[model samples]
Structures are given as structure tokens and as C-alpha cells.
Target: MGSEKQGFIWLSGLLFLNIFVLSTADVHYYEFSLQESPFTKLCSTKIILTLNGSFPGPEIRVRRGDTVFVNVHNQGNHAVSLKWEGVKGSIDGSNELIQPGRNFTYKIELKDEIGTLRWHATSAWAAATVHGAFVILPVATEDYPFPAPTSDQTIILGEWFREELTEANQTITPGSADAYTINGHPGETYGCSNDTTFEMQVDYEGLYLVGVINAVANETMVFDIENHRLTIVGQNGTYTNRSFTNSLTLAPGQVIDVLLLPNQNVGHYYITARSSSGTHITNGILRYTTTTTSF
Candidate 1:
């Protein structure tokens, strides 16, 4: 009897281990680097911050309800802060501080909603670097509430400054706009420039979603996707009836997802974002490259 009991216990342990392994295999993992780099001409010196050595670190794409694990490496001299601006008040929520030379892991069980999201830094020095987007899609066979496209892509918008945010904010008077960035960098370096190219192919006529994140403090942003009809999907990742037809006005921390209908006579188009207040200009290109492609 004792031998039989031990055998049963061992079998159960193995079964549990198998289950754990299978579950782990189902989830996806992504890693990113946080370093410092340059942004502009006026602030032509080196400013340190957490990023993938550039502005707008990287956009991570995953499925709804899929588990995500992010390994954060802090290469800076000071501690880093990571904040998630997804579903509120949960593990995916924002505002976390990560120490320097150390690594931390973040696990998020994505909700069953498909949209664009952002991971921002909560540290004082992190206002510039340590930012990126996450594009979450629905499961296969699931239909999007908006029109479907032959292919889709993500575009991240930001304002890049040459100096540290702390110094910029202090030197510039309050209620003044002094930020710079588009996509992820100020001068179009690191793929954040207003001239970076974006290409995609569409089936017939359909809607394409473009995500815009306003990372600055108080400036209102305006975006122009040349020759395309645009409709606002959601603000800050939440659905809203307050949709704009052509241009969008975005304040800091606001996210705008736009549904675009492309023109058949497409060669290459420039999707541009600028502060409605004339602060900065950032741009991305949308080109009709192929028939069926995934981004």
C-alpha cells in the first residue's frame, strides 16, 4: 500500500509539471533595452535616459488574453521606472520603479480587447526614453469591430527634446511647450523622424488602425495621414463616441486610434504628426508594398 501511494504521488507530480510546461510554451516573451542617446540640434549634447538607446523603445505586438513577460535591463547609472498605461489598477497598470544595473520582469495577462497601448516610465528622468507601444490583436476567427485590412501596421508618435526633461522643464517656463519628437526621435533618427517610411497593402477598400500617443505634458497634437480619410476609434485606448473625422487633437497621455480608408491610387504616403501649437513635426510613411503582409 505504501509503495502504491508513492507511485501515485510521483505520477501526479509529473502530470502537473507537464501542464506547467505546456502553459508556459503557450505564452510569449519580449525583452527590451533601456539606454541613453541624443535627440536634437539645440540640445546637441548627450542626455541620459532609459530606452532601447533611443526614444520610443519598441512596440510589442501580442494577442488578446495572451500572457506577456517583459524582461527590463537597466543600463543607466540611476534607477529606472516602468509604467503601463493599459487596463487600470492591475498588474498591467503603470508606475513602477526599477533600480539600475538590475533587471525586473513584468507579466501581463492581456484582456480580451484589441487595441494600441503604451509602456511609459514613471521616473523623473524617464519622461523621454523608456517609452514604447504594444499592439494587441484578437484571436484568430475573431472579427474586429472596425473594417478589416489586407495588411496593418503600428505608428508611434512622440515629442523629442535635446535636453533632459527635468532640465528642459525647469529652464522653460511653466505652461510653455518645449518638447520634440515624432514616432520616437526628434531628427528622424531611431525611426522616429518625420520622414521614416511606413508601408502596407490593403484588400479592396478597408480601414487601417493607426495609434497615436501624446507623451508630452500640455501640448495639443495634430496628425495628418496624407490623402486618406481618417476616423478616430478610441481615446487613450478606451472607446469613445467623440470621434474626429480628419485631424485629431491630442493632449499629453492621450492615445488616439484612427481608422483610415486608403486611396486606390497609392504609391507612397506620409503620415505626419505635429503639435497644433507648432511645437514640433514627426512623420511616418505608408506605402502600398504588397498584397498580403503582416507587421
Candidate 2:
């Protein structure tokens, strides 16, 4: 009887291991190219190095335990290399530096990372523009530990310099920025000539999962939604001991996941990102849809 029980336990362990292994063995492929493109922010337009002509590049999404292959082609004038923010690179030495007009393939295994992370250039000043969100979703068969939100949104907060990025980096003194931006828009509230701003529409009583990325080059930022509380869910691809806060601080290259349960009265609220040093403050709008007529 003792021998039979031990054998049963071993078989059950093996079966569980097989299921876990199978859940994360998928492979994904992507291609990114660096090119010079005109990006306008803070009422000025300049040519900057971008991935595939996107200022914040493109989001790379995969399931946990999946393998990802990214072919990075450097068509711009500067050397480039990508460093996955929280992922381990291939064991076969796939991630290497790519010179101007050269290409290199990056292989990453999302062994255990699952949450909001990012990828950016390791070269100088390129990270200011050549970066994008990297999301490792939970396995299809697995459910979230908590109740899933109604929707998910990605918000990238970054600093903007009016001059050329490389030149600005060399000349920027302590505590300075031309503007702060949310999803590449330095919203109209900042007095910029352009009226571009990041806006999200929310239905009454719906919950939202917000993935916030602090991609600022220099200063730490505080994110807050006026008159609303946020529940901390995860950061850097890992779940955290859930907590609630009215505001949260994020340093450069940090990502945070928060759950926003809009229980306030139906109206518009300002979602603000302000630098800790008081150098800049930017605003976006959260508009709630209402069914009743205003008084």
C-alpha cells in the first residue's frame, strides 16, 4: 500500500509538470526597424529615431513561458541594441549590438514574467523615442487570481525636450523639461499650441486595468486621477500585495499596473502626471459616459 501511494504521487507530479510546461512553450515572432521620423510634441516638430516610424515604437505581446524573436533592423544613422526590461535573453547569444544599417535578431524567453514590462534601446538618447510596451499575458487556460477588469489600457508617460534628443541630453541641466507627455501627447492644458491629449472614455460602474509606464529620461513622476482611488495590482510583470492609493510614484523605466474602479459621480476627471521636482505637469481626460440628462 505504501509503495502504491508513492507511485501515485509521482505520477501526479509528472502530469502537473507536463501541463505547466506545455502552457508556456509557444513561440512568437516580430520585426522592428529603426528609422528617422518627424514627431511633434510641445508645439514643435523634429526628426527623431523611431521604431517603425512610431514614437513609442510598437507593443510586443505574448503569453508567459512563450519564446519571442524580434528582428531589429537599424535603418537610421546610429547604432542600436534592444534590452528587454525584465526578460532573460536567449542562451545561444542572440542579442547583440547592431550598427547603422545593420540588423540583429533578439530572442527572449518569457520564462516567468507576466505583466506590464517594456523594451528600449540601450544606446545613448535613443531610449527617449525608441521604446515600447511589452506585455506577457497569463496562459490561456489560467484565470487571473482576482476579478478581471472590463478593459485594459496602456499609458506611457515620458518627458519631452524641445531640442534634438542627443543635443538636449548634453545641455539639459538638473530639473528641466520642455514638457511631459502621455502617450506622446503633451496635452492642451500645458499651454502648448497643439491640442493633442490622451483621452479615455469610461462607462459608469466599469473597472479598468491601467498599465502605466514611466519612460521619462530624467525625473520621477507622480500619477494621479483626481477624486479617484487606485488599487495596486502588479508591477514589472509580477503581482503585488494589493494596496490602495490616491497617487503613485514611478521612476524612470518603471511600469505599474493599477485597477481603477470608477465609483464617483458621472463627470470628467483629470488624470495628471507631474514631475516630482515640479519641473512639468501634464494632463489627460477621463470622460465617463452618462445615461441621464444633466440638471
TM-scores, all candidates, are 0.72, 0.88
In the range 1-295, model 2's lDDT, one tens digit per residue, is 9999999999999788557956657998999999989887766788898999986789998887788888888898876778788776453433566888888887787776778998888754788788889987788776776678888888999777677876235333435668888888788766766658888888877888888998886778899999999999999888787899999899877899999987778889999999899887899999898534448
Q: Pick the candidate with the highest lDDT.
A: 2
Q: Model 2 TM-score?
A: 0.88
Which stretches in model 1 have alpha-carbon errors above 4 Å?
Answer: 1-26, 38-45, 92-96, 165-179, 185-207, 238-244, 264-270, 283-295
Alpha carbon lDDT at 86, candidate 1: 71
Q: Assess candidate 2 and give its lDDT.
A: 0.81
What lDDT score goes with residue 287 in model 2? 89
Which tens-of-lDDT digit does each residue in 56-121 have in candidate 1? 677788765577888888777666667777744367423465667788888876654457777777
lDDT of 2 at 161: 68
For residue 97, model 2's alpha carbon misses the true position, in angstroms, by: 2.3
lDDT against the true structure, per candidate, is: 0.63, 0.81
Query: Cα deviation of 284 in candidate 1 (Å)?
Result: 4.3
